[model samples]
Target chain A: MTTASAEPLLSLRNVEVVYDNVSLAVSGVSLDVPEGQLIALLGANGAGKSTTLRSISGLLQAARGKVTRGEIRYAGQLVNTLSPQDRVKLGIVQVLEGRHVFEQLTTNENLEAACPVEMSRAEMRSALDRAYTFFPRLAERRNATSGYLSGGEQQMLAIARALMTRPRMLMLDEPSLGLSPMLTTEIFSIIRRINREEGISVLLVEQNAFAALDLVSHGYLIESGRVVMHDTATAMKNNPDIQEFYLGGHGVNFRDIKHYRRRKRWLT
Target chain B: MDWILFLELAANGAVTGLLYAMVAISIVLIFKSSAVPNLAQGALVMVGAYAVLAFSDWLGLPMWLAIPAAMVFMFGLGIGIERHALRRLAGQPIIMILMMTLGLDIFLRGITLAAFGGSARRMDLGISDDPLFVGQILMSRVHLTGAAVALMVFAALVLFFRTRRGIRLRAISNDYVASWSVGIGVEQGVALSWALAAVISTIAGVFWGAVQGVDQSLSLLLLKSLTVAVLGGLDSLPGAIVAGILLGVLESVVSGYLDPLVGGGSRELVVAVTLILTVLIRPHGLFGDRSVERI
Candidate 1:
């Protein structure tokens, strides 16, 4: 599944992100998302997964975070200095965590708001149609205020809004967070459809290792801001360490959990 | 109990309220996008009056040409202030931004004083001062024209918000990070907000100048407009309109009936009391959205 010879759509090489010029959040992280391929970045809270996504999208500035080292290349062009809007123009978009949407606006208005300023009325109509085709639930509630949407519905709207940009690479911070198991499966299937049908490369960051590994061909395991393990999803799922700590497999005694952390093969 | 006097005062108050609504709209525009109350709004209004005077009276441009020229000049000024002054202070505390606007108010006032001198000047937009009769209620022609223009501008704004660009601005106001991720330029939106606010303030200043001759005191319109913005809820556009009218009528009725009893000055007192009561009571104003917490 690794298209190593092809130029990746987005490649982050030795990226280091520092916050407020002092605290280091992500250091020496490297990864790639090949064209039209779905990739997963699996990590726990504060593991620098979201930070890496933000650095690529140029949203780090808002959090007073700066990329101090390494280069981020999109479509074979260095995008380290581009503004967030510029990055978006070049077809990179991120849906932030916690389902951020224009709560005051209707679902229709939320989608319309994401269209480029130069988009014509005809183009806008087509774009709306495209979003509706992907998330039919949103079309029914198009005129309802987005703030009142159910948790699952709002997550769908957030993804639909991101699609309004017609992005080449869609990076989701966590599409499955807080969603019920049933809703999570539904959303993941739709994400797979978008990747397969629209040919948009995806970089999904999720803490739900089971669902994320099921969705992507390749996975990167991040720990405290570094890429600890990168392998094909099948290879990672079969690894004994991953099965013990991440895949919900029980083998060791409860008291030895802390000791097991020290024995992680990758850490050793 | 003069019924006719009461009706007359109410009519006049409503007209004055419309003018206040125009100014309040300007303040609301800036606050919506940046979440900073533009304390310099009144100063912007005062300078707008002077800018029009400089173009029409000094540069000898026609009234039709001068109005838009002044708007263009102020538009550039608005963008400049946001880019050079306010943009640099991004991520600072909200208080720092508030203080910066206060500094802008004083700086603009000083510049106006230095350039235009400290004398009252009549801005005759050619609207007659004669009282016009609308079925027994006498209204000043200038007031009627000002109200008509304000209404038209309000209608235009409502329509603007329906456009794609306008919707983008609204989205930016709703959430900056979301807007940024979707490719809406947040900085440009903030700059555009300031430019539009400055343009609206110019229209406000013109009407205010027409009603009462322009002078250093014109800058004090900020106090009345601020009262209206706060009373209307700082972020709500319709709230500004309703609150402006409410404050206007309240002030007029207070001044009309109570001024004689109190010996001549109660309008300012009425405004102060209303503002205090609003802050203490409804704090979110009549139309402002109450912050909601989702469990």
Candidate 2:
């Protein structure tokens, strides 16, 4: 994807995040989401995937965490000093780790509040309609207090809220977390639909590798706060090491797999 | 009959409640956005009132000019305080934030004493304080006017929240980080909430000082407003208005009947009891959004 005079929509070059000036949360994580591309960040909990996303979007400040080193550029300009809200204006929006919808607001109000620019009544209504079309469940529960939404519904609301901002790039953290397989499928389809129809660049950080890899064209694996691997989704899916280490990667011989796990050099 | 006495106290309480609503709303606005409870809210009200004194009475500006100038000053002061003191302390423990506000209260009070002195200062907004009788119920026109102003402010606030900026306020209050990523300008939102609260406090302080007379005792208004805020739910704007009025009535009624039966000065005791009871029963405040669990 690297071509002269063409820049990735979102680029992180060796970004490092340190909390409380000491503990490193993310380090040397360099990757890109080219415009019109959907990229997957695959990692387990504590792999600093969320930190990378946070550093990119500037939420690190809220948690007393700072990006100590490296650069994050959006649309070919340095945005490391920009506030989170400024990044949103640049269309760099992040749906945080949990489904962090405004619990106190109605689903409709949640979307209305996320609007990036002031619009007339008719304009705002059409904007909301577009969001509702993305998740019809949200339309059904538009006025329901979001705190009462089912976990899956809340996740949809979070995405819907992010969409209301008119994001050029949507960075979502763990959209499939705590969702049942059926609901997970429903959400992933909507996400895929959003990408296909809207052309919003996606940087999806997920522990649910199976669901995300299916939707993404490219993938990066992060481990211990560092990028461990990168490939096209198809190549990563068939890669022997990834399947054995992740993706329930085991042969039918359970004892052999257990012995293989014991002897695994990476585990040590 | 005692029934007449009850009606009188109730009417009186409601009037006072409206004025308290001003203080309550200011506290609620800051608390909703910043979650610090703005211990200096009452002090801000005191400063706002004293600003009017400095503007009109001291500087010899007309009442009309003095009022707007004071409000503008208070708004800037609020923004400055948030940007200067509170911004640096972001992500601190809630206790630390609260104590910082307490320090602000002290600092403001010291400044007020130095500027205006400890003696009570009086200023009127040209509203008559004459008694108006309704079926043997006596009402002060000054207070009735204050109630009208409070209602207008409350209505204006309700309308403001319905606007784009207001929605952003609610969003910031609900989730600062989420609001930030949606282009809501969290720092500016925090500063604006403080500035908005300060503007409200100026209005409240002007009315309050006009009626109660300006003194160090004005700072005590914070405690009563905080009670209203807690009763209403610190994050709920409507909650502050409703709880403020309710607490005002409760205080007036308790002090009128219950205080005399015991001795005197039952207002503070009643407020304390009500706040404790409300905490035990509905810790989230009456209008506060329920912290529902979805396990």
Candidate 3:
């Protein structure tokens, strides 16, 4: 992380975090993300990838787990003292894991929920129209309740809702977790477009290594709550260790076998 | 024993039942939104009655002016309770929050007693206190008006929830994490829910005071209303209204006819029996959802 040439848009310096005393979720992890760059965080199951994002979002109190180490700076401000809501107001938004759409609310209502009142009616309408243009499926079901939407439509609605906030940097967790291959590719293209055209920085966390590597320019590989490798996406894609542990040998099909097992275990 | 006497009592019971339903609706609104059955709700009703009496009778203000003013004061009180107390203890156990509200009930009651003094004052609505006779049954003009107001409020609330704001509130109540990630102002929605509940409570207080006379004893009626809500379903507003009316009719019947053999206060006994049976039959209440745990 000590490249030392370009200023990072968001940087985590020597962060240490522990959860429940027995489980050390993250320790001595440092990450540097530049402005308008799409970076992927690749990790196996239980490798502290989710914990890192949670800390960044201020949803999980790092103080509770003894930061014991370093500071997180965003756009030249020390954000460790700010609450989750304050972080949101400061243009940092996280699209949480699982399509966390307000299921009882309509698609349009859900879109309007995250919208700050700062935008004028015309501006809001344009932004809303842009979202509808991006996902016409959501537009078709604009007044429909979220629970009734198909899983893919719900995911689209979730992303659309987050975009309504007009975030400077969007952090997405498992965007393609359970989607079909075609849907996964569609979402990846949108992520790439957001970074390239919209100039919105993306901090994407995904276990779909093949897709993530194709999408992100640079990335860091984490294991057991520590960073084990860091390089360009091309280098990480070629790494044997990542392929064997996370990518299921070929790294082509990321249908999430472990998730299937986990769900099965719960049912049994 | 006459049919005319039975009909008269039934009409009176219907009016009183409607007032109880309005109060029960308030309890359901707060309970559904915050998942905290506000014990202080009864105290809020007593405070509302006292506010109306002080403004209209003591301060010599017109009833029209005092009504909205009393509701505003109660709304402020509700917001204050949420900001100073409930918000801080957001994730605490339900029992712990309920206990805190119970303590709040005592604190509010003590304050009201200290301020208003310990005497029953007949609150004049400045309307005709005369009862209208229909057959052998007589109903007060105030009671009839109270019924109308209660009906209108419930209708309005039903429509409000179907609107955008109401949908947002219900979404938050159903799942807060989903609501928050969608950028909903969940904390604000929760506060607004409490404020709305307080406004309804204030209206209920005014009507109850008109029928029973405003005093410290007004708080006792809250218990009966609470019992009705619990039986009807604490989460269902319509259930609360239906249960309130049903209980009112049942009590009136017992007192009017069966009391001769069972002795007076038999109505209370019947409510107690019904409460026990309801708990056994449907612990979640008649309209409440069965508990569904997420994996």
Model 1 interface DockQ: 0.90
Sorting all predicted structures by TM-score, with the top scorer first, yields 1, 2, 3
DockQ score of the complex predicted as candidate 2: 0.76
- The candidates score, on chain A by TM-score, as follows 0.95, 0.91, 0.86
Per-residue CA lDDT of model 3 for A1-268, tens digit only, reads 3442267778998777777555678887789788889899988788888788877777665234445557888887888767666777777778888877877678888876667756676887888998898888899999998889988888888888888888877889889989998999998887787777777789989989889999999998777677777899988878765666566774543555575445434532
Q: Give the CAPRI rating of model 2.
A: medium
- Against the native chain B, what TM-score does each candidate's chain B reach? 0.97, 0.96, 0.93
1 or 2, which is superior by lDDT? 1
Which pairs clash in model 2? none
Error of 3 at B43 (Å): 0.6
TM-score of chain A of 1: 0.95
Q: 1 or 3, which is superior by DockQ?
A: 1
True contacts kept of 3: 0.36
Q: Total backbone clashes of model 3?
A: 1
Best model per lDDT: 1
Worst 10 residues of 1 chain A by lDDT: A259-268
Q: Candidate 1's residue-wise lDDT over B145-176, tens digit each?
A: 88788788888988999888888899988999
Cα lDDT tens digits for candidate 2, B64-151 = 9998999999999999999999998888777888899999999999999998899998977898877899899998888888888988
lDDT of 3 by residue, B1-295 (tens): 5878777777777777888888888888877777778888888888888887778877888999888888998898888888788888777767889889898888889998899887877777766887788765788889889988999999999999876578677777766765655456778888988889889988989988877887788887767788888888887888887887888877787688878987778877877877888778887777765551110
- The candidate maximizing TM-score is 1
Q: Which residues of candidate 2, in runs, are more than 4 Å off?
A: A1-5, A118-126, A249-268, B290-295
